[model samples]
Target: MKVALVGNQNSGKTTLFNCLTGMNAKIGNWPGVTIERKTGTIKGTNYEIVDLPGIYSLSPYSTEEEIAREYIFKEKPDVIINIVDATAIERSLYLTTQLLELDTKVIVALNMADILEKKGIKIDEKNLEEELGTKVCKISALRETGINKLISEIKKGDKLKRKPIYDVEIEYLISTIQGILHSSDSKIRHSRFLSVKLIEEDERFDKYQTQEIKHMTGLLAKKYDTDFEEIIATQRYNFIEKVREKTVIYKPVKDDLSDKLDKIFLNKWIAFPIFVVIMFLVYYLSVGIIGSNTVDMVSNIMDSFSEWVGNTLQSIGTSEVINSLVVDGIIAGVGAVLGFVPQLIILFLCIALLETTGYMSRIALLLDRVFRKIGLSGKSLIPFIVGSGCSVPGIMGTRIIENLDEREMTTMLTPFIPCSAKLPIIALFSGYFFKENSGLVSASLYFFAIAIIIISAYILSKLVFKNTSNTYISELPEYKLPNIKYIAKEVWDKVIAFIKRAGSVILICSIVIWFLLSFSFNFEYGVDIQDSMLASIGKSISWVFYPILGENNWGATVSAIQGLVAKEQVVSSMAVISGFSEEVGEGSQIFGNNTIFSSFTAASAYAFMIFNLFSAPCFGAIGAMKRELGSNKKLLKVVCFQTFLAWCLATVTYQIGSRIENGTLHLADILVIIAILLIIYLIVKNSINKKKDKCINCPYSDSCK
Candidate 1:
């Protein structure tokens, strides 16, 4: 037996899905999330519930709605749990009507009934069930209310059929449209629900449209002297109004905290400032104060373990090669990266709090004007904000943008924003090179990242997506105080995900990296890198980074080589090079004791940080970009552009710094000039190419052109 959960967006469908399945669940990319589908099973039941992506209607305007529609029509589940927002039944009923048309066995799970009661609105469940011809189950999915009864009903396998509730006028109109469609096109045959959809010019019904519907739609439009879609919309609302009159009762409203808070939070002038302070506080707690300290402590413990392992292996008479792989390459490479899990957990915690409390959406709304000026919708802000967490998920978040052009633009520029994984590298470089002003250095790097994104967006706007249209509309959910239990669960879930990922993918990749930097038959040395193949490869690639880093800097180059798999690996490789010593803290005197930066400024350490920070993201991010961008050509373009841009920024910074430090310009100054000119030329060329195509603002033209 199977059960399917369906609902409108933000109607608590997912909350119910989680509650029903408990820990017996799995989350993956659906069409909206990416990939194909995500499924989870109910524990100890023959019923395996599939949670359908949130959709407004089954007319299939978007991929998510199509996925939902296809699943219902194809798979034909034994029971359907239509999760509805009792408080927002007017909007919620749209999808419910479509579900009724499917003629499947269904029970209405009126979720968020608690919220409705607080709002002084009451739903007559028995009357609704009688009128709609289906069973009604009131549930507060989050609070575990009515779940047992819901489960019992599922087990009972009692099938209920609902005659779709429609007004008399809508019924006549739908009949007229259906007859017209069927008469006009023999090919287009569906239930009356689809006939109404055809009148609305739903593109999905085009394939099902017979010549009859086509001719009938034209005749009706001439008869009504209005577009058929507008006519259908009017009918839908008319039906909703009648149903709402009968089933809903509104009592005297009282002013609540939700309303009071909205006045302050949704205020145009004060909201952004408050939001900025909140964001600063979140980062301060995560990366600056408590979280960083926690991470540092964990890192110290891991470092000690690594040191003990190294010493024990040597004392046990193990070969140097074996000890190096186990201690230096694998442990050192992966541990340095994994050490930041605590910080990530704290950061995710703060974000989850903001999300749960419904503040994140407010920020998006507040920033809509600013975003719209750049030809982006408020939805684009969602991905941009998420980019700070990690570009992979950030880019994935672009799926929220209904407009294809806006989505592409968001995806292209998201990686330019510094993610959590890149934070350690920035901290290391800035702390080591610029004493006391570490926060300023970090903030400047972040600002620089934002600058790159804005400049790139502006440049691309003139070239790539010039013809694309932008329509911005986002619903703002009422603000509520966050639940403590929910916040804890959210934070814990994120932390566990990070730990699990580190243990699996990062650990395995670290081992591979260790092998690459460890194994080699060194015929010349009569051995390898301590007799390893990876050492030979690192040496071979060392020269490639020589101009910016140095030929003898095997460690830096090795870290860069490992950085392809994960950006944090660069720092891990550094720890390995520094001998995995627990004593080596952020401001280690031994390494900087002989550093060349204070004396000579050519390709200085500061410039190196800028380069690494701006360079192409890790392999995982690249793969995500490829999948989101949907083309290999676009992915390659992003990588090349990022590398080139990083080189220019680094070259210029080094040349300028060297001139200031040495009291004279060096020959490398000329290389810096040429690099800057090349970047400018590319930017101009992209703009010119877009202009030639008659596209005024191609938002992603920088890479596309």
Candidate 2:
């Protein structure tokens, strides 16, 4: 049996799906988290459940809404499990009304019944079932309550005799459109649905009908004294209000705990500071002493294993090249990334806890005021937070933003947040350059990324998206204690994914890099790495980073380039080239001994890290950008912008920082100063131009008068 799960955003639909299918799908407390559909099977049954994206309605206004509507129309699943939040049934049932219009059986799973009870609200399920013409089962998906009854209801397959709920005039218009569609060659199976859509003037079905339907819709709009779509929406809400009045009973109560907590956590004066402190704590615990100690332990174990393999290979008379390939190429490279798994696990766990407990949504609300100043909506916060885990999904999360320019700007700036893939790079550099306060260094990078994003947003708004309005609305879920089991599973999933990539993409790239560095252009074996093809290739573009690193070090240049493939590869590539098979601890002198690290000072290392952190993301994220941007020209523009920003920032950091540290200035320092002044000039000029444009459009303009 195929079951399709549908609900409004934050309706606990996904939580119910997880309970039914026993799938560890990532659930967030915000909308647009599940932009794509996911499928899983019931553990003890032959039933397959497909979890569609959370959508408000079948109006097909957004991409996710369109996806949900198309799947229901085309796939026609056996049963539609409509998960509705008991606390917000009126708003949720609006979608439920649309679902019932389709030719399918729907079992309404009233989720969060416990929350309803806690709030002294009682739902008359029998009355709801009778009004909606569907079986309504009360279930608390979070606590795993009443799930068996819900399952039984799904299995019973009781078909609903869906009654039309439109007004007399709307109903007459719908029937007329249905007759016209019936006479045409349209392949629409749900004639009633098609008819209502025609009256509503839904663009998706415009190609099916002709100018007659549009003309009829125009007449309906004139008769209703509002939009045809608005008329239909009003009818649905009127019906839903009646349903709520008949079935729902609410009792007065004192202030709830969520409200009490919100007084402190959501307070305007303290919320932002609390959010920053919370984030700082998360980073500190994940990358500071605790995480470092765990990583060191894991690194020791991996080092022992690597040594065992190497010694065993040597004892068996393995050839020099094969031994080096296994020990240096695979083990050193892959192990360098794997060693940081503990830190990644901790980071993901913290984020998962925040998401599960619903604090993330509040963070979005708190940051909305700040975002507006930079011409972005609060919705952009979701993508930025998600980007901390991975930039691909983060970029895809931009779909929730209705504004095209805001979405594009959000996409361009998301990669500035250091993702999980970039953790190893941050860890390695912090450990080496700022060993005493690695956590502080890492956390500062995140804050620096935020600063860059804000500044970039302001500049982009002034130059590209002048006078863009900032409008955002988001639902805030009740705060609940995070599920430990869910947090553990989420953390494990991320750790496993990191390991898989290390074994696949990073491993393959490591071998290729090792091979390239080991062989000359003529393909001769056992060539000196400095004289090899990889070195020659790296040197060709090494000069681009000379200002940042204070030297034309091909190793740093190559590592940065390899990051485009996978961010973790930067550290892995460094380990492979330096031949550091064992744990590469802080100030290990591995790179210092090798020529690659010989010229790098403390400032240069930081510059290198900043450059990689703010630069263009990995290929996977780039692919996501391509899809989201929808054009190669835009993608190219973003890529160039990212690279330019990274270069300028890194150059300024190295040149100015080196001058400050050594009390000496050079020609590069003067050039960096000039570059900074030029950027400021451009920003001021763009702001002036934007003000001029705004004045030109103003009603008070002298020309308009």
Candidate 3:
């Protein structure tokens, strides 16, 4: 049997699905996280449950709503499990009434019923069932309470068919529309439901709008003396209000804990400061002194293991080439990335803990107030929050935003926030230069990213598109104690994903890097790295980043290019490149005593970090952008814009920071500045030419010209 789990956003539908299927369907306390469906088999049962995207009602005003409506219309499952948020049952039932019009069985799963008493809300389940004409099961998906009985109810078919909900006149009008549909179309799937959609003039059914149906709709509007859409919606809410009066009770009490805490977390003056402090502490613990110690311990273990293998190979009279391949190529490259596993573990744990405590929701609420000042609503923050995990889902999460321009802007901006893939880059630069103060450096980069995003949004709004006002309303989940098992699972999942990449993509890329570093164009083995094949290839295009890294720095140049595969490949490439060639000095690690990056100053290194952090993401994320934008023209434009902006920002940072901090200037900086200015002048010149052409075509051109 197939069951469809449907609900409003944040109503715990996905959570309940996780409980039934034992799958970690990504859960967020805000909207836009799960805008797509996820399916899993219920444990120990033949039932497959599909978790559909949340919608406020059947009306297709937004992308999520359209997805849900289309899924129900096409994939008619055996049962519809509507997971209603018990705390907001009145608001949730607006969708429930619409669901009943379909012939499918719907069992109302009243989630979060366990906490109703604490919030001074009382839900009489029996009364609710009687009023809605459906069976009600109270289950807390997070706590795993009352799930067994809910499953039993589904198995036993404990549900009631819904009765007509609206008044007699409204029902008569709906019946008339259904009769018209039946006469015009013999294959109507859900005549009752389609009739109502026709009455509302939903765009999806435009093809089925016969002249008779249009005439009937016009007559109904004249009879009602109000907008047909408004009257229909008002009547539905009126019925829901009557049900709430009979089924729900509110006891007089003080504000609940969530409301009380919101006062401080959402305060005007201190909210953003608190968020900054929380984020700083999270980074500090994950990348600073504590994180560095754990990473060092892991690095030492790998180092010792590699030494043992090398010694054993030598004692057995193994070929020098084979020994170098094993120790220098594979171990060095993969280990450089794996050593940072400890840091990722800590970082994922901190984020998971914050998410469980509902602090992430608070951060969104807090940021929404500030986002408005910059012309973006809180809806955009959801993508940025998810982007911190990885950019793919973050980019996909933008589908929930209704405005095309806002969604496009969110897509372009989501990647500016540092993702898990970029952690190795942050660790590499900060650990080498900042040392024990690495946590501060790592956290500063995060804030710097936010500044970049804010500035970019402002520029886009003023220069490119008109910004519209959008109010963000999210139902804040009540805070809870951290779930240890959930946090552990989340951390484990991310760590394993990182290791899998190291073993696969990073592993292959490392061997490729080793080969490039090992041979020159003449196929001479053991040649110096400067004369090697990799250097030849890097030098040809290394001029692109000359302003950021200075001239003749092909090692960093190739590393940056290799980052397109996986950001971790940047470090892995450098690790492989650092080991070979006597001219660069042999080093045990990328930042050891005789490091290959010795020529790098703090300013140049940081500028490089800024460039890589803001540049186009890995190919996986680019594919996501292509999928979301749905046009190669837009994708190419976005990628070029991102790369160009990153280059300009990195060049400017290098030119200013080097001159001020080092009291020196390179010829590359002057040339980069001139090139950037020239590009800007050309863009402006093209805009002027376009305007002149528009004027030449105008009817009033003679008066204006």
Better of 1 and 3 by lDDT: 3
How much is 600 displaced in model 1, in angstroms? 10
How accurate locally is residue 592 in candidate 3, as Cα lDDT from 0 to 100?
A: 52
Residue 299 CA error for candidate 3 (Å)? 2.9
TM-score of each: 0.83, 0.89, 0.92
Mark the 10 consecutive residues where model 1 has the least summed lDDT. Answer: 26-35
By the TM-score metric, which is better: model 2 or model 3?
Answer: 3
- Full candidate order by lDDT, most accurate first: 2, 3, 1
Off by over 4 Å in 1: 24-36, 153-190, 201-203, 211-223, 291-303, 434-437, 483-486, 500-554, 580-591, 594-606, 653-705
RMSD of each predicted structure? 5.3, 4.3, 3.9
- Candidate with top TM-score is 3
True lDDT of residue 523, candidate 1: 34
552, model 1: CA deviation in Å? 8.1
RMSD versus native structure for model 1:
5.3
Best by lDDT: 2
Task: State the lDDT of candidate 2 residue by residue for 1-705, as single tens digits.
Answer: 889999998888788878888887778666777888888987689898988888888876567777887788888898999999898888899989988877678989999988887888999999999999998999999989999988887789576667678988778877888888778855657788777887777777777667887787677677668777777888899999998999999998787888999999999789888988988887887788765677557767877898899999999999989998998899988998998887888889888888778888888888898898898888898899888999998999998887878888999999999999998888888776777688888888899999999999998997787655678665788888887887788788778889999999999999998898888999998877778778899999999999999988888889899999999999999888877322343435335544466567778878888999999999999999999999999999999999999999999899777887798978886888799999998888988878888889898877753
Worst 10 residues of 3 by lDDT: 581-590
